[model samples]
Target: MPQNIVVSQPEDLTVAWAQRVVKLHEPHTLVTQVDLVSVEVGTTTRIRLAVTYHAETALPRRWFVKLPSLAWRARFITALPQLLETEIRFYQELAKAVPIALPVCLAAQSRWGLGSILVLADIEEHGALPGEPHDVLSAAQAGLVVDGLARFHARFWHQHGTVPRYRWLAGRVRQVEDHLGTVLAVPLMQQGLRRSGAAVPVGLHQAALHYARNRRRAMRFLSALPQTLVHHDCHPGNLFWQQHQAGLLDWQLVRIGEGVSDVAYFLATALEPEQRRLCETGLLARYAQQLHSHGITDVDSGQLNGRYRAHLVYAFEAMVVTLAVGDMMPTASNLELIRRTATAVEDLDAFAALPI
Candidate 1:
């Protein structure tokens, strides 16, 4: 068996490491040179590399790698739950079976005391355009994403009776994250709201703060519905656009939850208010229809609509909390997401829908 190799910094992407990774997957291939192409630092450090082989082979020359955040604050926030570790597990265990478009995982590994590392065949090299947080999707583009998510959710719809691997997705790590979010929610919401200023309407402030105060209860209410594997964080920046389909990325937040929550998060963060108003009703109907097509016939339209409205609260809170956790994303993009999700909450009366 190959030894555990965890990469903690840019300097650690050595040719020897590349050779080891290649050997694990393709025994005959020998990696000759590993050139650093670019580095993007945020919630995680994304490094792109151009590789050379000793002999001609069909393997990809360009690779996209994910390591833990280089920033201390982002690292601190993510380390407690081992977010990157969750992502590595997803790529290792679930990526192959799920019928969604995603980058091919080349190698994924994590060590106990050290961090995790993921190497993927660069989707850009495969002719896909990555979406950005600030990029608003058109109604047509939003439909594609919705359809893709429907298929993904249907695959694991109410899959609680499944194998142990799928069940491992929501264990100790997620519980720690939940506890941390609950303990810190009120303060974070307050800070985020203050930072938001006119971006968040004054009328919604009390409702948002109230939800924050009672977040634990609200979370239970949201999770009361049918459970399925959810992308959890379905923001535009974590998606990529191929010719006609949208691919999911950043599986750090994947978990078991209501499927419509993914739909709500995506529409809230990916669409502008005006566009969302025009597209949302149709997109939701389409999502339901797709689920039905996948033989998930038990979903009721009325209940799905209600759950969608109720779930918008989390979408709003997610953006606000992202703003609170400074340096996780670009400021302008974070604020814009806040504005969009706040609009979604107000427009849907999401706070009123919450059981809290």
Candidate 2:
């Protein structure tokens, strides 16, 4: 494949380039015209392409292309090579092995200074829809997501030490610790805190402030727990759903950590307060049952409950830091995530449960 075929902009997606990429999946098809259906820019750029194939050729009408964002903020944030590398590697190496539903990567590539590009099958064409950050998940939707997560975590559970192939997935906690100072200093942090302050309990807010000072110690404690492959960024915006089926997107933050982090983060950030309060215990129980069915018998409800609480602090800090440094445009969603996560922390007494 020619390197020039990899593009950073929609204009660069010529018909020839489109054909080359589509041919990787459909050899006999010829794309006549490539229309730019939609463009969504964030930490990454998502371009939807509507292709007109030659008559009698069998090819999908639409495909989704993911490339590094051209926006100054997005490019600056994703400039960290590992951030793009992780997602590219996930699609290239691990996406097939995982049992959970995720987008099918038709093609993907990552270059150090140049941006990354991922061509994926359009799940939207098949009834899957990306989740909105501000929208809350109902009980049924949350259950589907939890079930998918259980399968994903169980597949890679306890494999970190034994599998050399997974060595790349470690060090997520350390990475967060290293970047905490810069993240805290971003101007959006104060604004986000202020916007959501009323909904955040005093104890939880105090814990967040204190946790900032001792983040290293807190991360160290969590890292010492049993490890498994986690979709470290499992909040609402990174998820997709269709009826009973839930699909996860954005593999950039995938890492080795306590699997319950995904559970805690997803439930706390994605569900409304009353809905979360009603469904949380039952969901946790359901997850435990799924884990057991998948042959992970060492963890019981008590251990999961404790770890889940501790992880609520981790999830809260992560959301705050991410909102602090990343796209501050979604202020409402950022505030909701912070407020809901803080509520979970208070409800669970997560700060007290932390080893620090």
Candidate 3:
């Protein structure tokens, strides 16, 4: 086993560390410079590295690094231990098996109760860029994302029990349910609910309350559906686009759950209401067809639709909790996400779809 490298600060990214990262991709590559390009600190510390090599080599000129946030509040809110363990394990153990594109993990290390460091190939150089949070995706762009998600989910469909390696992907839903009450009771959650009243649809207001009140039931209903690996946070900001196809970023929330939950969340948060309405059914069909192509023949269309409807509420609940606990993005971006998701819930009659 390779020993884990300890890196807690930007200063720790020395030439030796750069060499290690480059060696994984090209053994003969020599790293000459590790220039810091940008630093973003939120739930995680995202740093962009501009590199200089001693000679022409296969190593990328730029890389992206993810490390534990230095902020005390962010550290507390993010549950750094679990988040780091999950992301590192995904890159190390599951990235190869996934069919869709993901950032190439050059180096990843995690330590319980401490922090983690992840170095990855900078997809930005490959024409991939993060989706703007406030900009809703066009119908064609949304279709590509759904297709990628379907391929990703189909790769692990119904294999959770058969594959011991996937056992780690379990338990996130239960963990969320276990902590839902505390999350709801927090002052931040209450404040967010009060501030968001004007944006939430009148019909779905009571539905949101139902989910908050009947947390266990809501979680159980979604969890009981067909299981597949899902990017639990598939919102626009965690996705990147290049050449009309979408690639996922931020694997911290990866889990084993109903794959339609990802679809519902993505459609609700990433599309304008008009675009979603025009393209949702078609996108769902596209997703199902992709699954079919991957030999997943048991998913009934009606059942999938029902689950998609129910999971819209799941997406709404998740956004509420997210907006409550932390400043997930800029205020305008976060509010837009809440508004769009609420609109989706009411439009789909998601409250009636899964009556508590």
Best by TM-score: 1
Candidate 1 local lDDT, 1-356, one digit each (tens)? 66666878988998998988888778889988999999988889999999999998878999999999998888888999889999999999999988999899989998878778999999998789998999999998999899999999999998855767787777899899999899999999999999998889999999999999999999999988757899999999999988888999999999889999999999999999999998888899999999999999988899999999999999899889888888788999999999999999999999999877
Worst 10 residues of 2 by lDDT: 180-189
Ranking by lDDT: 1, 3, 2
Compose the digit string of candidate 2's lDDT tens values, residues 70-159: 677656656654566678888988899888889878778876566678888787877888888777988998888888888888999889
Tens-digit lDDT track of model 3 for 1-356:
66556588887777888887676668887888889989877768888989999999766788889887776655666662367557888999999998887888888887765567888889998788877667788888888888898889888888987889888677663375357444553454456677676777665665567567776676778788657898888899888877777888998878888899999999999999998999899999999998899888988899888889888976776666666656545667778888998889888888788758
Instruction: Kindly report the root-mean-square deviation of model 3 from the true structure over all alpha carbons.
Output: 2.4
| Pairs of residues clashing in candidate 3 | none
Best by lDDT: 1
Model 1: colliding residue pairs: none
Give the poorly placed runs of model 3, Cα more than 4 Å off.
1-4, 23-28, 171-188
lDDT for predicted candidate 1 compared with the true structure:
0.91
Each model's lDDT: 0.91, 0.77, 0.79
Kindly report which residue stretches of model 1 are placed more than 4 angstroms away from their true locations once superposed. none
Location of the lowest summed lDDT over 10 successive residues in candidate 3: 180-189
